[model samples]
Structures are given as structure tokens and as C-alpha cells.
Target: MLKEDLKTVNEVSKLTGISVRTLHYYDEIGLLLPAELTESGYRLYDKGNLLKLEQILFLKEMGFELKQIKVILEDPHYDMQKALRKQREILRLKSERLHAIMALIDEKLEGDEYMNFKAFDMKEIERAQEEFKEEVEERWGQTDAYKESAHRTSRYKKEDWQNIMESMNDIFKALACHIGEDVSCKEVQDLIEAWRAHITKYFYECTPEILSGLGDMYVMDERFTNNINQYGEGLAQFMDDAIKYYCLNRL
Candidate 1:
């Protein structure tokens, strides 16, 4: 490739609006590496690297971790065109869901009692849940709890899943109410315990390890963070800290 066709790390960072630190970290993780290194020690990325970086960002938006993205990219049989098509479809569905949610909010503001039922309608929620489950399975399918949870939830009735979600939201909202307090405080720890118990009761047993991982996911995954933060600002990070404290001290 022509030297003029290559972009330096800083140039790529500026063009993509991604931080240089993140690009360096991606390089270190083998998720995305520069196409070449100049004799003067500058990292240069050609168009191919830029294309791979685009794929990496797309998968990240879909909640795929760097490791998973690496595996997907490294797979010889991976089809970029097919993956983009799939991503487009998923984004379309998500856009439609967001539109529905906005409409529901407007209806509620207008005092439409009958329209309230649409807010609780579990069809789209359940579909999104299933998609998340599949993504988790793809990422952590080897874990026993992942397998067990999949099997158990597959048998749940629509109503059961709805109740489970409602209970979870209640716990999240309760935790949000204590967001500014110490995470290790009795009230917050008790809520974390309740959250753990809720998971263990409905899904597979949530061991300390699982609980800790779930806490990390709450902060690391945008979907979980957005959902929890809907109750209050910073609630997801607060809940994560509370769960970690509960595991360390209470468990």
C-alpha cells in the first residue's frame, strides 16, 4: 500500500473520534492492530485496518466484548457483509422499540389509562431478553450457570418472565433510591442481597463469582447500564459497587 494511503494512530483517532488510549488498548489486546509500523516508529493503519476497526466498533455497540470481537474477526469463515446485514436488522428493531417507548411515554403524559397496558406488554421486552441471552450464550456458553439459566428460562411462561422483570426493576429502583449513600451501608447491602436472591430464585444459583461478574456487566454493558440508570442517574455504577461490597463482606 502507498505510504500516503496509511493513517497514523493519532490521525485515526481524530478521524474516528475514538481515543488514542482505547486504540492502543485494542492493539495490545490483538482486537485491532496497525497495518504497519514506519521506520520512524509511527503506527500506520491502511484502509484494511480501518475496515476492521469499523467492524470492531459495530460489534462493541452490539455488546460484544473485545475478546468476542477478536474471535469473530479471526474466524476464517466470518462474513463481514452478512454480519453487517444482521447488525442493520438488529438496529432497526431497536429503533422501532425506542419509538414505541417514546410513544408510550407521551400517551401516559396525556392521561391515557388504556395505553398504559402497552408499557407493560412483554412481547418486545421478551424478544430483547432472548436476544441478550443469545449474545451471552455466545460469549459465555461454557459456564454452567449460563447453560442452566438458558434451560430454566426456556420453560418460563410469558407471565413468569414479565413478573421476573418487574421484580428486578423494583429492586433496581429501590437501590437507586440509595445511590448517594455508601455502598457498604446496611440498606444498600441488603438491597444487593435481595438482588442476588432474586437472581438465584428465578434463574440458576448466583454464586459470589457470578454475582461479581454480573455487577461488572451492569457497568460494562450499555444495555444493562441504560436500563438500570433509567431509575436514577448513576444507579448502575452504585449497584455494581454495592454488589461487590456484598460479595466481599456479606457473602
Candidate 2:
């Protein structure tokens, strides 16, 4: 029947890069079940199932609840095109945030143009800061560290933050070089200590746990990993492991 051209659970797992457990959970929750089951009880999915999975992944990444996601997916009136358009808008916001970060780096490389006679049409930096602060707060809740980071724009001059950003970038470059060679060396350890000291200056009451947590986030979160690994491959994972090791040893 439906199993004629469908793939087995193991085959689907390999093809989709989704774990077997997650697939089973989705089936149990009636989120994205296989199209058919063979006599031996092997789950089999068809091409249509793959399309549904793509939709499921898209909605999940956008932070939709499973119940809401199922309703939306099942609704014949639900327009995938419209949903994608909304996702584009969300991506635009994320792109603006990345642009702001790049602008800070650019300001470090190039002289400040704001002080010149040329007038700009908008306050891009302030807009970016507000949007970023709101998004981070909404997602992670307002932690003391995040609050401190938000108020940073007011406390320190733009030039100062630019300098810090450049310094941090340079440090990551150094770390990436070490990772390419050997991560468990004494040199890497010393550099990590310096990095820790640098971080402690801005973040309030920085602890080993917090530092290590950020390192893990660096690799786990695509944005952070992409930024850090711009210089080298696997650098983000190297940093995570190094930081975790340092935290366990030092703390």
C-alpha cells in the first residue's frame, strides 16, 4: 500500500537528520505521523510527509506552540505563503540586528561619520538597540546581566563600545587560531583567562557558570556560532569546550 515507496524510520532519521526519538514523539503527539506502517510495525513516510516536516520545523523554529502549530498545519485556509511572508519579516528584524553589530565593527575600522557635517536620516543605532533589547528580554527574560548590557549604551560612549567589540573580535581570532592547533594547551588556557577578565569588566558579577553557559550558547545558538566561527571552522565548539573546561577547573 503506502509503504511501496516510503522510507523506514531509520532511513527517515538519516535523511531528515531528526532523531528517532523525536520522530516517535511527533507521531505519538499526532503532530507528524508516518503515512503508513508495515506488517512488522515499521513506520514509513512518503514525500508528502517530508513537506509537512519542513512546515513543522519552520513553525517550531518560529516559537509556535505544538497545539497551535497542529491547528495551523491542519487548516485548509492556512496559507504557507503568508506564513513564509511573516517569517521573512521576522528574519528582516534579525538582519537589522546583525547590521547594527556590523556597524559597530565598521565604526571601529572607519572614523565616526556622525561628528561630520553630513546629517543622517535616522538613528539606526538606537533603533537597533531597542529592538535587540526587547527581543532578548522577551526570549530569555530580564536577567541582571542582560539589563546591564542594555544600559551599556547609555553608560559608555559609542566609541568605547566599538573599541570593546573590536577587542572581543580580536580575542576570538586568537582563540580560533589556538583551536586550529590545540585547545588543551597552556597558551589557550592563559588566553581564556584573559577573555574571562575582559568579560567580567562589562557583565555584572560574572561567574564561571555564567561564562561557561555563554560559551555553550556560542556553539548552540547559530547567530553566536556564525559570528565566532567566521574566522575558522569548529572554532565555536572549541571555545565551548575550552570554556567549560576552564570553569570546571577554576571554579
Candidate 3:
């Protein structure tokens, strides 16, 4: 491709209003790879890359997390046009909610009684959002996973949960034992698969995609990070790297 047909990462960032660091993160996650790399080591984006980045940002606005966005975008049959239309329906629901709130403001401006607070109800809006979430789960491969997870967990008693937590902690602690070791090492990779199997046995079938998402969450979600780190300092990051290595290399 002609060099003139590609824009440097900086230019793409400027045009998208996405910081260079964020763009780099997108690349690191395989979310939005640049179209070309110069011999001097500059990343470049072509028109197709720009379009994919737009879809990524739009999905982020629709409340899909980075991992979810990655999965959706990486789908073999992913249709940008269809995904846009689906998410637009969600925006339409939000717009209707805004109109309801606007009517309440107008009533107050006109000196009408407004203490009933009926317009402030968010049940409809929340339901719409939930339905949209279900649509995503259904369209993706996670609907059965969610349902199976819910069914399996609903029967766990207090002690069962306690035992489960113990096992979970043991796995993390075992993983923590290998801190500073290569994440792709056989021991670490084994631990990672053990982790995946634990989730499937107790929760639901943890597919590689779902497992990968949980790996990202280990560091991205503070709660998960803190919980994992309690097993050992930096264990969260270790778990993240180890799981990521397992997913990318050993899967």
C-alpha cells in the first residue's frame, strides 16, 4: 500500500480524539491493529482500521467493556451495519427516557404538580437496557453460559460457597507461587487451565473467549485485582499475564 494512504498512530488519535496511549492499548489487546508498520517502527492505520476503531468506540459508548468489544469485533460473522443498528435501538430507548424526564421538567416549569415523581421512574429504561444486554448475550455465544451459570450457582449452599472460595483461593495462591516465572511455562499454563476448569465445574462452561475476558478483568477490575492480590502481592497482574499467555499461546 502507498505510504500516503496510511496515517500514523498519532494522526489517527488526533482525528478520533482518542489518546495515543488508548490507541496503543487497543493494538496491544488485538482490538484495533494498525494496517501497516514502517521500517522505522511507526504504526499506521488505513481507512479500514479507522472504521473498526469507530465501531469499537461506538460499542464502548453502548456500555460494552473492552473485552466484550474485542470479542464482538473479532466475531467471524461480525456485521458492522447490523451491530450499529442493534445498538441504535438501545440509544432510541435512552432517548425515550430522556423525553420522559423532559416532560417532567416542562410540567414543573408550568407550575403543575410534580411531586408524584412518576416521570422519574427508570424501570422502563432499565428494562430496555437489560433487554439489549440479553440481545447481545444471545447473539454472541454467552446466553447459555449465563443461564447455566445461574442454574448451577442457585443450588450452592453456604458451605458449598465457602468450599468453592477456598478452592479458588488455592488456585490463585498456587499461581502466585510462580510469580516472576514465565507465564507461558508449563506450570503456569497448567494452573491457568485448572482455573478455567474450576469455573466450568462450578459455574458454567468457561469457553476460551470467556476465560480470556476473565483474565483481562483480573487487572482491569479493581475488585477482582484486590481479591486476587490478597493471595499475594502482584498476583492479579501475574494471573492476568499468565491467563493471557495461556489463552494466546496454549489455547
Candidate with maximal TM-score: 3
After TM-score superposition, what is the CA distance of residue 175 in candidate 3 from its true location, in Å? 1.2
TM-score of each: 0.46, 0.44, 0.49
Across residues 165-184, which tens digit of lDDT does each residue of candidate 2 receive? 56777787888788665666
Location of the lowest summed lDDT over 10 successive residues in candidate 1: 70-79
Q: Which residues of candidate 2, in runs, are more than 4 Å off?
A: 1-142
lDDT by residue for model 1 over 179-204, one digit each (tens)? 89999888889888888899888767
Tens digit per residue, CA lDDT, model 3, 100-131: 78988888899988475666677766776677
CA lDDT, every prediction?
A: 0.72, 0.65, 0.73
Ranking by TM-score: 3, 1, 2
lDDT of 3 at 20: 98
**All-Cα superposition RMSD per candidate:** 22.2, 23.2, 15.4
| lDDT winner between candidates 2 and 3 | 3
CA deviation > 4 Å runs, candidate 1? 1-139
